[model samples]
Target: MNPKVSIIIPFYNCPYVDQAIESAINQTYPNIEIIVVDDGSTEFKEKLAPFQENIVYIRKENGGTATALNEGIRSATGEYIAWLSADDYFLPNKVAKQISFMMRENVEASFTNYNYMDETSQPIDHWTRPVFSNNDDVYRAFLNYNAINGCTVIIKKEVFEQAGYFNPNLRYTQDYEMWVRLLIEGYKIYYLDEELTKFRIHKESGTYKHQQAMQQEISIVENEYKPLLKEYIARNLE
Candidate 1:
């Protein structure tokens, strides 16, 4: 039996968020539940009015994306879970193709390649996300760098249940922490060679900005992954 997928979208007044929601609602796969978290958007309320009941809209006081995402995950009803940002969109086949791969491979988490687009939505560059085609590579890629962008991941609900939600303490780089924690735990990871998501790079983009949040992110990895990093390194030695 195919499990329903809960699609979580964390948003601010990002003009592009509406486009992201539109893309999710029109998925070729209808077994999806769309949950949008309005993380204290002062202007987007009116823009989002039309999407009210069609999409599960939750308004929370201004917090960070990590908190907003945690709220969405708690409200999700589907057996499978995935996340997207307001400024990004997914291909029509994004859910179908990736979910099919997860089921066939019996993996807990999966992601695909992505393209970077300009504000006008033109592709400027691409990051082929096949950095971790297998579980072993997933661990390796973590220490080297994070490759699986949160928007591109479709993970089983159990991953969140066992591994837990994004760290509330983190305002940024929560996705990197989440992804690394999963890989370190020996969870099965599969990287589809397909590009099923579009990531837009613009001024308000949180992760794209190299700021203090970045420094905090590195501190997070060093502190949280300390034990696991050592364990993975020991196991990898041939």
Candidate 2:
């Protein structure tokens, strides 16, 4: 059976969202729904007007990325759920290829290796594949998301729900927090060895301010998950 995939894109005020939308609308997989959550923007929200007919647009008040993702999740009607950040985009054949892998393996979730690009789509570095002690351990990989770019993951709807909605309070490390939660709730996640997604590291998006935002998010992550993963997420008070 061909799985229906919902590509939920949380759009903030970013100029790059247009490219991101086009990449989604042109997916090689036909059974896909493009849910673009406009996170309350006047200028950026209007940018999606050109593709309004092709994509499902949801307008919500500005909260955070997590809140926007939750909106997208509730509206998703696909067997598989994937998130593509507004400022980032996908490589052609991303949806088609990943969907095949998921069905072939019958895994709960799967992510791919990806490359980073600049504004002009210049190559950053061909990120080498990481040797995971547990290839199907998707939750553990999110603790240190080197296995795949968060954008590279196409999550199963059941696994996505088990993790619950994105934590609205976490502005920085919500993906990390939620993936760990999914593991605690017991979801099987795996990785694809191919580089199927294209991740753009622009100033507007990404965990750029990691030094400032990550520490606070780490506190939240530790508080919520330490009881569950004390070994993996123990506090380092050095």
Clashes in predicted model 1: 0
Residue-wise lDDT of candidate 2 within 177-205, one digit each (tens)? 77677655656567777777677766766
Report how far off residue 102 is in candidate 1 (Å): 0.8
Task: Give stretches of model 1 more than 4 Å off.
Answer: 126-133, 236-238
lDDT of 1 by residue, 1-238 (tens): 6689999999887888888998898888869999999988877567677777779989899888889988998899998888999999999999999988888888878888888888999998544444444556666667667767889989888778888889877787788888777766777567898878888989777766767768877786767785787686678633
Off by over 4 Å in 2: 126-133, 136-148, 230-238
The whole-model C-alpha lDDT of candidate 2 against the native structure comes to: 0.77
Query: Number of clashing residue pairs in every model?
Result: 0, 0
Clashing pairs in 1: none
Error of 1 at 180 (Å): 1.3
